[model samples]
Target: MGISVTNISKSYKNAKALQDISFEVKPNELFGIIGPDGAGKTTLFRILTTLLFPDQGTATVAGFDVVKDYKKIRNSVGYMPGKFSLYHDLTVEENLNFFATIFGTTIEENYNLIKDIYIQIEPFKDRRAGKLSGGMKQKLALSCALIHKPKVLFLDEPTTGVDPVSRKEFWEMLKRLQQKGITILVSTPYMDEAALCDRVALIQDGKILQIDTPEAIVKHYPTSLYNVRSTNMYQLITSLKTYEHHHSVYPFGEFVHYTDTRSDFNPEDLKVYLESKTLSDIQIERTEATIEDSFMELST
Candidate 1:
């Protein structure tokens, strides 16, 4: 087994951080948990990594019970947290060696597993960890996590705060690791990143809305969507929400993704309506739904 979570729940004082959450990550599969901040992604990661105890439910990682076999699970998995937790005072090589030593393994013992990532930072091995660029820091953290060749890897928002080019490169590294039979579980708030995973779970306010392949999730969008834009972006949004036939209106990049309340709605009629409201240069075209669109529909 890779990971199994059943009815997991947690609370902090009066607030419930996670509410009866449950999901499975198949062995060797890249599973993603997609949600924004305060959605309980970190709480769930901490519980699975054996760093925190849940108030309810049960979980297992790498076929070992999270509560009963915490020690075994910690040894069998590698975790790269959302923030950089490595020693800033230590040199790159020094930090790497420290982590490896903790797991009773030397870098040379598992050089093959982290060679792809380590090679990129090896040139700066003499430099202090705090002096490295954001991308470099990310690579070093990942390298340290993989030093012991864990069977399961848990990356919490690995690409968050990095450049787009670096983000792309990071995902490529994860795919190569998956090829070597390491089960991966990653969490991200970016909808685009969700598509790269084999499957995803959309969560909001401590509850799971839906879980499926990205393609299947978008296909399940219940209504026809359209891209709407006009001279005034703010007014266009305001006017659409007040329209008699409007169903859902959300700002997606430069265009407003809108759905109609009527099944036989016409774009031309909407354009005419906008014109009557003093909005000009109105453009409305049918567009396909995205993961974000499906999430908005479910959360609403």
Candidate 2:
């Protein structure tokens, strides 16, 4: 088994963090938990990693119970928290050695497992982890997480603060790791990254909105989506929202993604209405649904 969560619930005093959430990751699969900040991604990760206990329900990681077999689960999973948690005063190499030693192993014993990720940071081995750049710190953290060659990896928002180039590189590294038969559970707030996973769970407000392959989720979008744009973007949004038949309108990059409540909706009808509002240079056309589109629909 890879990972299993059944009716897991957690709360923090007056607030509910995760409410009866359930999901599973198949062995060797690249699973993604996609959500916005405060969607309880970190809380769920902590529970699965055995750092925190769920208020209700149960979870297992790598064939070990999170509560009963916590020790076994800890040994079988590599966890990289969202924030950099390594010793700031320690040099990169020293930090790696410390983690390896904690797991009753040596860096040389698992050198091949982290070779691809470590080499990039090898030149900075002598530098303090806190002094390394954001990207370098990310590599160092991942190297330490994999120091013992755990069967499963849990990366919580691993690319949140990194530059775009580094984010891309990190995902590529994950792809290679998946090919090595290590089941990966990654959480991210970036909707664009959802497509890269084999499957994704879209969560919001402490609830699961949907779960499926990104492509399948897009294919099942409930309404016909259109991309609408004009010279006055602000006025266009205001006017679109005020329209009588409009179902939903959200700003997406350069265009507004719109859905109509009527089944017989026509672009020309919308174009005419927009022109009535003195919105000039209006462009309306059918557009393919994206993961972001599906998320917006589900979350609403």
Candidate 3:
């Protein structure tokens, strides 16, 4: 195993940030902590990186205890926090060099590790970290994190607020890094990214709702689900909410995802009923469960 989390828990004043969290990451595995805001993903990353002490339990990275072997853990792991934490006033080159020096190494010593990522941002090497575009800043931060060639990497919501193209590029970079045998623990609010990881742990309100391969998570959704949409989306949603046979109905972009209490569900019957209610352009279709759908089921 590359990382082991054993009953780890943390809190801030009266609010619980994590509750007896436990999981293991095998070597070179891309492990994701999937959840929304205030889900304690940051707290868990901070504790594992030895930045904050956990209220209870223990965790280890690269075979070093986060508490007693703080220095060793720091030397063997790279962390990119959720927020851009580099020296904003410093040029891109300066920031990367500084991080390398702090780890008792030079960029040249481990340049190969970040070469692929650095090339993209090298054109803006002299630009201030804050002045670079979001995508460029993201690349620089990732380069700095990998400069020391740590055994494990922790990324806390690394793609938040970035454009879709940049987000896609950033994940591709991670895939390359994974190919080089680095274990990654990344957290994200975007459910689509969950499918990219080798395995994921779904978290909400400071609890581990489920942990498994994304495919398995989706398959575990107990009830059959359908996607429905109508010209009067608002009325359609309201009608579904009060439908006696429905188990759950939630809006999902252009369509609403719905499940029911009946085992013998008939879409034709549903269409006739909606037509009688004066809803027009109603569309309904059976759909495969998604990671997001499974999350909703577990979190609810």
* Residue-by-residue lDDT tens digits, candidate 1, 124-179: 99999999999999999999999999999999999899999999999999999999
| Residue pairs that clash (backbone atoms under 3 angstroms), model 3 | none
Candidate 2 shows a clash count of 0
Alpha-carbon TM-score of each model against the true structure:
0.98, 0.98, 0.97
Look at candidate 3 and tell me the lDDT of residue 15: 95
**How much does candidate 1 score in TM-score?**
0.98
Clashes of each: 0, 0, 0
Q: In model 2, what are the clashing residue pairs, if there are any?
A: none
Please tell me which model should have the higher TM-score, number 1 or number 3. Answer: 1
Ranking by lDDT: 2, 1, 3
Off by over 4 Å in 1: none
TM-score of 2: 0.98
Task: Give the residue spans of candidate 3 off by over 4 A.
Answer: none
For residue 171, what is the lDDT in candidate 3?
96
